[model samples]
Target: MSNSDSSTTKTNGDQFARKGMSNGHASGMGHATVEIQDGKTVVMDDGRKPPLAIVLKFVDVKHTVAIESRFSWSAKRPFQFKRQSAMEKEILHGITGSVMPGEVLAIMGPSGSGKTTFLNLMGGRALRGMSGNITYNDIKYNKALKRRMGFVTQDDVLFPNLTVRETLMYAALLRLPNSLTRSQKIKRAEDAIIELGLERCRDTVIGGPFLRGISGGERKRVSIGHEILTDPSLLFLDEPTSGLDSTTALRIIQVIKNIAQAGRTVLTTIHQPSSRLFYMFDKLILLSEGHPVYFGKANGAMDYYASIGLKPLIAMNPADFLLDIASGNVNDVSIPQELDKSALPNGNDEAIQPPAKDVREYLVNTFNQELAPQERAKLFALESTREELKLAISEKRLWSITWTQQFSILFIRGLKERRHEFLSWLRFVQCIAISLIVGCLWWRSKIQTEAQLSDQAGLVFFIAIFWGMFPLFTAIFTFPLERAMLAKERASDLYRLSAYFMARTLGDLPLDLVMPCIFILIVYFMTNLRVTAAAFFLTTLTVFLDVVTSQGLGFLIGAVMMDVKKATTLASIVMLAFMLTAGFFVQHIPVWMKWLKYVSFNYYVYKLLIKVQYSDGEVYDCGTGCQSVGTSPSFHGIQLGGGGMEAWALLLMVAIYRILAYIALRRMKTGG
Candidate 1:
């Protein structure tokens, strides 16, 4: 061969060798050889046997999640302060199972059967009372292992304003490792969208109660896509198909099956799946009343029931039959005496001998005797393989991004979400409309009379109340509506709680400032209050500060109560109390109740406005005589501090309320 031809051949051979080496390493092979046989290239591996690849196209891989849990809870003792009582009911009782990669494990149970609780335990999201031992591929479950897993909650808690792509991209940014570059993160999010069949609605907004957006199924897929952005090895989904139609539900399960087939461990809670969907599950965990009725192969469930002398009627769906047995609706069926004596695989007769009374007892006894030992043995075998395998555990931080990155991403996301909320637009419109109405009502007020001065003061006080009460009441629903989403994300350790709280506070500030500006601009010029540029700007500043302070109050209530109704009711009561004692309505206060006004934000705000307008030696003409309004009877003993001092005081209140809200958010528990 010529020199150039020989060099070319050598280069081709080197490329083949590199490809073989990469494949060999991925399959856990120590060495590989590329050979030319029969004019064709062949790759041979010489090392330990390779694991069964998820499919011919995917690499050889395996991941197993084994969990054993017994959980219960404590409750507050009625009418007893600082006292607690442990509930007699058990949430889970010695539940044990193992889910392996390349398979789907379906957890099914009737309502209140601890299905969700068990899933939560496995996902490391269980409440404080949970007691469990969970291991991922022989590594004990911890924050590190949690990083390699994905959790999709039952409720599709997504940002209603963002498109499907934006939602996944943000999730990718927050959840993916720092090792991935921006382009890689974007690509991963795109891949997840295509993988979950969300391309059709990639740019579609995830709509909520008021916004027009994606369908329920599409939203559900987006939620799933959010978790899968990092391509986690293990995925846990809670009722993923819960409100979806049969076709969409089957499609979701199929996509999930495809994910498992791609070498990811998938465990999902399903409620009454169709026959086809039921068979899609590789393993089935049937739970009832906090007890495991069966934990074995999904396809073999019917046969297992037959083995226990409880054969379902022909053509009956296996899932329904299992549910019937779980619910104790099945009639007693006699077992053959000889079969009862037959030794199970574990050399135990417990499987053969049915319980004398409850079906649940019989099923649990049989599973413990016959299947538990085998499952345990399988788990041990899988764990034993880990000793020889070189498993690299990537220790990752709870948050994948830095604090600044989290704040930035979260701030941008919050702004986008708020932009789409109907209430947000409504608040803006309400501010403008109320401003116009108030300006029209107090049109061109002149301080020609002392009573006109009072009227102007009333208008100023009304402005304070409008700006303060509106934002405060509207902001009350902010945290409560998104509490579920917050809990789910926090449970997954996506970001710091402080980061989210701060981002939310800062993100809404721009809009908050803008709305008040529009209101004050229109009303300031029309109402004809102090015409000086300094006075107009000062009034604007005071009103903006007042609105911010009110919003801070809203945040506190929302965070502390975490329920819209309760927070709204509490905020209404508090605002009403503030209004009653604001010094304008009730001039003469009782001795015991005189200090209440000091606690009211409205009182401080009214005082600040009064000082800003009248503190500069302005005069008003009475019908009989002209007098200085600043030194009038209404202003006597009110102590109208300097505008700067009053501004600082309003700012101080804002800071205090915001700090308290942050504290409450930090102390609040996201999930049970």
Candidate 2:
């Protein structure tokens, strides 16, 4: 229904201009510009004026990590490994810089030089184990300050199944201030969509490797859009242009420049950048081995280096040259004789190049002695003249939405994200195929006689086992997969942990329960375990309890082990153990293991299914005559647990496992 030519772009631009005029979000000077981008029509920009906001400053920031951590542990004796106190290493050493409104600061360095670490400290993503003074508008990082900040990580943490519009809408709902009405929040989300020029693909899914959706460049934009929805004044991006092509990367930088020009203070870490991209930054901080080599105007960086007698032998990208200098690759540059000479004690060897480490040390020392003092003085002077730390945002609620609103919004988002897999064509076919096979295999399992009654009990047990394992396997991956996204949102103070936990755990119900209902309808009638309406619903309820309890165990295991492969493997082992000890597979678990059946929630499900279909002291016809169930060996282990206990036990397990999962998730909310 839409076209992608320049005329279409013009029309789209006009439509956006009118919408902006109506909503008062794009308050401006004049008309909008339109451009044709990659066969898609997009508005160039909306006329929004800059509203000066924040000035970010950090001083003497440092961070250290254990050199001999778990990765260094022995494979043969992993449990015996311990890190000595001496095995610590510094990651960021006395790094300091600042960026004010209407300016974009780019952090550049070689790998392991702590560019991202420095950015993380400034953005308030790293707290403990870090020594620093990171403040926004003269205020330290806090819940209120967090609400006004945004961070785009190196890896785009997003719901791959949700459309671009939906992702931004959910962020708006959860992250916007409570002062805004529902309609206002929705308006804000729509405005972001148009503002980002994502109108062409607004409804398209933000896909992953397996799912085809938005282009990588657009996906990156959506990541930016999510943070911008709250109208954050301070934005931090860790390599937003990473993995992007030259033109796309340049475009991304330009967009970020536009954001900075709108009175937002932006900081981003970038790798090798082209000359065109290099000139876009207002300021640059060059790091080397966790030490600051240079912190000054981006345009004057090369001039500063040249003044210090370090200049490239040939024309090259400024970013590449800076990286070379930061990496101690001064051999390619004409370094000052004073710095080039090494402490070899052999001679004043003009013929030999200094060691890389020596070169790095010189760069660090030179900056600390000359430029650092002046930079600090200027930033402090600016800070003194700035208004007081209070931004009125500090008194606002840390979380934007009420508990009920968060629950409902998050629930809907979860449902949308999961529907592609939960209600997929393949899943539908899988449910049908499995149910048909089970129904045909257990056809008309008559329970009139003693022998057939055992067969009926087998069918009941199989149903409980099937639903139990199905949901557990599926639910095990939920939290582990979402850990990164959860960490990012939590850092931004988007929503309450309790709100997210409840929404995620309970939101799965509608989709999780669908296939079970369908499978039960088919398998129950075909197996003929029970014929009456009450018996049918009771059986369904029993299986649902089994599912709920098992899912809780899955969540617990997943939350505890945030690795997908490890969590899935552990779930398999745990579920297998539960099934074996639940009295269905083994007649007599050893006395020491007898207590395990009580611990296994599967035992409860099996018990409830039997009670639903059969009464106490029930009898069945044997070859000789009607016989009591207690006299038969077929129902030996199942009957001993007694009746009227499964429901409460299963419900208890549900609560306990969910609570434990929530607690585990809280430990990771701060990304500790």
Candidate 3:
């Protein structure tokens, strides 16, 4: 046999062996060999009984999407004031197409061609100012249909710290139906890993900029594996192979093609594919400046172009050729005077010039007048035949799991992810270093003299500031960095917003407590602020509350900003403002700015710490004299709000800020 045939035979044999091993037949029956010849399973005539074959079953449902739209989407401004000056950009201009079952439709276009926008609109990711009918199997797109569809965005948007298996397992737990047992959900995740050829990296971490982990191709497969774990009837992938090497890109596309062949509708936006990769698409949707230039079979695209007197150069990749045409690179192409331009909208006239139109406009006008009718007829025929098949829509449930279950899963996953960073050796060392520095700064502070008392008061205020500022700044990056992942998951309706917010808040509590406890233990005894254990415990409690409150503020800022740099900038400015009014830097505030203290978390933290340390009413010796602790000389001009009240205020701020964070997350979900 030739080498190619021999390699194929070996591959098949390995697959059978692995299957038998997985089915628990290999160990019991010793060694067995199986093969397929002429589409028939053949077993060797050995004395051993043939091992039972293992067959994996996938959801065989088919979904057809027919979408027609004239839509416009607005760009989101960083500041609301800029929105008034921003203009609405038209994306889709009355484009129409249908994706049938057992077919892979590739949407192709140049930069700013609205290819991704069109796909987002059909996937129900965009709903604003969209005027059109999008139907699945002749029914209007609804929550039920959305639940049955899976959308894979261009960016992977996964937790870099989590392993491949953990990521897919969490996705399965969240997206799969509640009727499925836990073992079945786990089996689904395993099957997805196998299907995506990710068995090797199943336990490898999905690395990001901070850490080295799996290869880019493996990460892409894991992303695909997450979406396919649910086995949705309709799958949408946006730029699935945009950044991979040519070989990896081809492999990814081949997997998608196999998915289509297994009776699912696959729609994807592909850019600048190779000739081999381009041919894998069963149908093509050519878009330019939000208009359809061509919608037909992938192989017939070249013929259609030649019919319009625009043949590509010999041996050119078809995708590259189509992109050139869409980008208006074709020269000397004449626009037919008889072509109908009246059907096109007048609003986008600026996008296309009059008299002699650009290449994209020419193709769009021609397709609408000549080819679209034929495509529409095919969709209509499919619609008419829908009655022949019994199509059952699964009953839609908003959440696949209960609230307690969601919180439990999310807590475990969040804890596992944060444990890698929150308690890292770097963070531990940093905290220890900060503690030693603070200890040495106020080494063995005493209450013997007024200057010493003032020094001790400064130390206490610094402690409050450190705890408040450190955790807040560190936690500010949390939500902004995960915004994309959160948006995608929320769009999928995986869990309730409250469940995620609570789990995230509660998961970080342990780490938040750990750092503050270490800081206080090292600093409190070294400074000798109070000798009593009760006093030290109260001081620690005060600092811990400050940390929690600061973390809550961070969550609010991160959720509201949704951009790491922007949120960090805002947090810095806000923290600086709080510190300035925190009763240490400025003793007597201006009457006009007195209101700043009420909103400042650091102000309350400082007050609570002072109360915990000085509430004993002890006496201190000034440089030249002695004074009572509650006197102005000992306590500095700081107002002694009762420690109990200050602690309650800190707790209230935590609740308020977290509530606001949840609201911001919800607003992000609704596109408010």
Best by TM-score: 2
TM values, all candidates: 0.82, 0.88, 0.82
lDDT score of residue 194 within candidate 1 = 58
Computed on alpha carbons, the lDDT of every model, listed in order, comes to: 0.72, 0.78, 0.73
**Tens digits of per-residue lDDT for model 3, 1-672:** 344544211113234325433432111111234333332334533222222111111111112234444434446743433223434556677766677655889999998888887777777777566776676666555665556677888988899999999999998898877888898788767766765667788898999987899988778777777776665667889999988989888777877776554446788999899999888899898987777888889999988888876776466778888898788765333233433332244675532322324556678878888888887776555542323222345546466789999999999999999898888899999999999999999999987777788889889878888888888887888887777877888777788878888999889999789988888889988998888887788888888888899999999999899888899999999998887875566789888877888889898888888887885467777555766777755455555546777778888999999999889878886311
Measured by lDDT, the strongest candidate is 2
At residue 232, give the lDDT of candidate 1. Answer: 68
Compared with the true structure, what per-residue lDDT tens digits does model 1 show for residues 1-672?
Answer: 344433211113223323423322011111233232222223334221222211101011112233444444447645544424433446677766677756899999888888888877777776346555566655555676656677888888888788999998888888877788887788767766655556788898898888899988778778777776655677889999998878788777866775565446788999899998899899998987777878879998888878767775456788888887777555333444433554233465245333333566667778788777776676555542323222355665556889999999899988888775534677678878888999999999977787777778779878888889878987888899889888988877889888998999888888778888888889988998888888788788888888899999999999999999999999999998878765666778787877778777787777878887775465666666766676665653566547566667778889999999989888888741
Instruction: Return the lDDT, model 2, position 533.
Output: 92
| 192: Cα error in model 2, Å | 1.5
Q: Clashing pairs in model 2? A: none
Model 1 CA lDDT for position 621: 68
Number of clashes found in candidate 3: 1
